[model samples]
Target: MTMAQRIGFGTQIRKSPFFDATLRWGATGFSVYNHMYIPRDFGDPVQNYWNLVTAAILCDVAVERQIEITGPDAAQFVQMLTPRDLSQMAVGQCKYVLITNTEGGILNDPIVLRLGKDHFWFSLADSDILLWAQGLAVHSGLDVTICEPDVSPLQLQGPRSGEVMKALFGDSILDLRYFWLRELDLDGIPLVVSRTGWSSELGYELYLCDGTRGDDLWEKIMAAGAPFGLQPGHTSTIRRIEAGLLSYHADMDADTNPYELGLGRLVDLDTDFIGKAALARIRDQGIRRKQVGLVIDGPPLSGPNTVFWTVKKDGASIGTVTSAVYSPRLDQNIALALIAAEHAVLGDRVDILVDDQPARARIVDRPFYDPKKTRPKAELKAG
Candidate 1:
């Protein structure tokens, strides 16, 4: 029998609805995100990566707090949050957007879903956008109700995720287009199912509307997916790095602007937003630093970097390695870094202080693997 894990923390930290279910399913480790305990370990992370890419894994990402905005003025109020052109956003469509501060710095990156003409939900990353949105609504003349609902999200990701989804909801689930959401019911459990996931694989995220049904929802998914080799797993850092996906607070934070991260595509200057003037000025002035990919010349990284490793070029500090990890598929240590734009040349050699030891590295493309994202956005076969 496995030894019982004891956790010591104050009541301030919240627990997800699937906490008990995950613990019963062999989740042995946890990490705090958005003031909630998230399962980060279920054994070997490398094995978890293989499971996510080869088969499928169910992740309790309940920490992705849903900030619901609904009111007569919700449509106009939502547009003031991000620079993205939501004018053409249709009901049931989801958009990945950035919430910025007055300085144009990213406050939080959330996926906004248009549930109705004036109803929306901002499924957030690590930061607290609920407070930000609520605080903003206090003074704005817009009529909107901003609050956190009883919703929690679970990611069912991998190449085989489709097959598993079909088994659960029938073949109709396969027709759901990418980045779109539909209200669904499974055995009396109310949910908002979306053809979206963070794994950069063909996957789905099931948003449990009722928190009380967490255990029931988790068990149902696992049972339905057992035939397809489904495993209880955490989000894979390796696959995310390989896909060139960014992690908030690691790859970016409140101080990081969209242009510096090459995410200017998410910023639409033509639209009026909270930080439009600041972003416009930054765009005209050009960015001083840029985020890039690097191939660290060393043994495979044991795990993700815990600190910002210093990057130097010709004995001068140029930038810092934000996030670094070994990609088992690539068989190399790849990293994402923010460095001076002048030193961001591809194929340029730089030295990074890994664990206080000097290691040689070369500038490479952002994504070490699929550049065009063909895997996640691949078209499904018609019947």
Candidate 2:
């Protein structure tokens, strides 16, 4: 119910190039992601949520670290990291993938981008995947160079994001298909633009090739977005929960496998990968618990949950709520929970303890909002 203690910064944690800009724009709080200070709140969470849904907003997501893998055997090496079948992945395409340990536990869920014939970047979540990949490479004697490139990404998201992007990058950016990327220059500054984002909305990510240009790029995009009601915003927790986007380390972690997180579609049993055998066995035994959505019948939560709340059935603990938010659009408190596989049914009723008080909840299908998933790829209509 009370605000969290303030975060202190040190050399142990790195700051993004846009840190100053976010602080200047009224960033009220911070959270560490991938060992970097990420702006967690700019002001009111509800307003930030609304702005992202109705207008355009900019987010400094440089914490989405990039693990660069390039070499003659780059593609081969990358394939050995995950269960996803990457044989058909074309250059300039992005795929949502999970890097698993040999035990079939999820290591990281990242958006794998193929930039060239022998180059790839894993736009990672909050995990030390770079070291994991490097260790693997060294042990396997793979012919590849692995490093974290100095590329920081900014996300321009919302319904009006396309317009803001068009104003800054020209109408040609409109042709960028969802989950695809393109390389371009802005005022001679090299950049990689991708039709991708965490929120289930029309959006694009601009990866800065020059870290020094971070302020310059932010200013240009903000100025161009001024006409479209652009605001400095942090990643929207409400929107992500509504869209059923999983947050790394919260919904799942290294101990959690793909099937438990409803990511079985991302695993390819036909492919040879590090966790293929373990996952195949998991498939045969069946998952014990699985992730599902929840509609809580209670008052709005006071703030973002700092700890996992217990989910119960018949006054007995049955699962845990990892992430929860009050969605104004849906007018109910929603949450993501990992519950017993048999209790993960759509209509199962359960109870959750929020702020130490009991509250009733029901199991629901994921993506409490935009279940049809038509927003992220929708074209911006003429204003």
Candidate 3:
């Protein structure tokens, strides 16, 4: 297959809003930014408030959804690839699952949404999860099918997501709960509505059959949300940084296991799954390193990768910051870092390297905020 055909979609269209909004927001332009893939015409703030905070906004996350399973052995074959107990996953339910190599190293982090008894959709990062799953299917000799679904996803995220959705769908959406999804027919087009999102706020995601419905969906959401102060917005990397969400490549990679990324709860080691043995060993023997939140005092003096902890008193570097941001909520610079297992203590002081200078840092409990999941999930979620 040609490279274009291999991508399984049309030529990538960067939402114009990405460049337009960044210039208007008075933030650093994308010229130097390396992480977030923004689109063209990514819109101006209706007022000045972040669009997500005030009203609902839509994002064409077409790049994020990729299906990698097809053929006869797809279903049963892919089950053993992750650490999650897939047998318990109900149809139409979405659960977070990790894709790993046989050695138990992470390959991609994706949400496994069981669409049918034998079909699955894995919304993943910019990784080769599809290829990985195919490799496993060939090795396992299971007669199942796997292939990327021909669908592009759009996200409606914001605090007023419900209000906007109510205006459009007429209150039918308010009943959906977090992680729940339903099929809806709008304008005679089939779409899957899921109360799941990436924004650390109340939101919902919609998966349409293709890009043909993109314009209509966008217009409808905006019109419905007008009364609720909805505004168009794009994904913000900095915001996620403060929210303590892990970015696949930035915060973790193949060598990093879920346990090392503070995702031990998601991995049911007790249940049979790939990587269980390695994780069990790590848990029993104890990890030599751990991921922790860092509270940095003073001005922001370092970027990610700054070492702030050591295994011995100046003996060797144990860990470095994987993610960091100047938090708008706490008005302090907070960071997520991996540190020596022994040094992972609450209120423990460590050293942070800032501008080649060692600065004193302290280990704080994670989340850095929202220790309690206090946000309520309304039925019609938008992100």
Candidate 4:
């Protein structure tokens, strides 16, 4: 394709620094997220999932943009954005947090990195949190500067990711604890390496601090991982569903509350936040819908469902299946669904319309792969 043909998608949508690198390395399809082009395809998704679990895969996740918050009142201003307690979050630590609205509805679920005493970066899922923060700062009597920094991230995830990291950053990278981060210099290539990722596997997110070095960063990591069987891949939907990770707009959105997803642990009612009062009311009254796991009874799904499948208990519709996939390892069709609280009992069976064809499923436990997360938490001692 010529440059004009390649660039015909319009310049309004931003491209990541690793955009060109991704296409060269086998990225076949793309999707839009946070107004940026995100690589969604790099061959068969099932093969991508296997490549991730068995070995390692390098994913260009620059679309997971960072919203940088800094200033004297930064900490306080950040606290107002979510119900999660940030008082005990030490510097260089990472915490998975839910950004909520005043109505106690979830805005986005992001992993926040505490860079300094008053500096933080919200590694977002897929929403405009930068605009939200800037808007909040205008009226809230807080002195905080909110802006989008020139940062892009790549995910090097799988069982052998540590070996890949050690090859690139040496033994010191092993000491980097899970959910913690440290800034590192890779031959003068700026980065903030963190032991965190969306996949429930031992992995690291390499945040490229300089946009100009995107190509260099991608090539260096791939070269180091080549000996370890690393393949260029996209985030795995089958694996993520097995891990029970919530997608921002899919599983829960602006209308979904924290309690419904069994994520009340992230909320601190004692501390005042944007949605404390509304959440307290929810806590008192109880939630209407609840998130649950399901084992759909049928043949293996051809692929992950693209739309919400209607879930019905008996003859009446109760909820909808947000995410569903066929786990090759488990040999079962697993799904995450949201249904009325009264009908969400374990072992209860429900009917679902899979492409308008009737199907049956039973309520089951989620994170079907690793509910305890023992794999991701396992130490990275050199072999």
- Residue clash pairs of candidate 1: none
For model 1, the stretches where C-alpha displacement exceeds 4 angstroms are 1-7
Across 243-288, the per-residue lDDT of candidate 1 in tens digits comes to 8898999999988999999999999999888999999999999998
lDDT of 3 by residue, 215-249 (tens): 66666666777788765655654446656777776
TM-scores for all candidates: the values are: 0.97, 0.97, 0.82, 0.97
RMSD of each: 1.9, 1.8, 6.1, 2.2
Worst 10 residues of 3 by lDDT: 27-36
Off by over 4 Å in 3: 1-37, 40-49, 68-75, 300-316, 355-358, 376-383
Whole-model lDDT per candidate: 0.93, 0.91, 0.65, 0.94
Residue 365 of model 2 has an lDDT of: 92
User: What lDDT tens digits, residue by residue, belong to model 4 across residues 1-383?
Assistant: 77634754678789999999999999988888998999999989889999999999999999999999999999999899989999999999999999999889999999999999999999998888889889989999998999999999999999999999999999989999999999999999999999999899999999999999999999999999999999999999999999999998999998999999999999999887898899999999999999999999999999999999999986999999999999998899999999999999999999999989999999987778788999888798865
lDDT (Cα, tens digit) per residue for candidate 2, span 1-383: 35465545679899898888888888888888999989988889899999999998899999999999999999999999999999999999999999999999988999999999999999999999999999999978779999999899999999999999889877788889999999999997789999999999999999998888888888889999999999999899999999999998899988899999888899999998998999999999999999999999978877668799999988888889999989989888999999888888898889999978888999999889888879998965543
Measured by TM-score, how close is model 1 to the native structure? 0.97
Ranking by lDDT: 4, 1, 2, 3
> Where does candidate 2 clash, by residue pair?
none
By TM-score, the better pick of 2 and 4 is 4
Alpha-carbon shift of residue 356 in model 2 (angstroms): 1.5
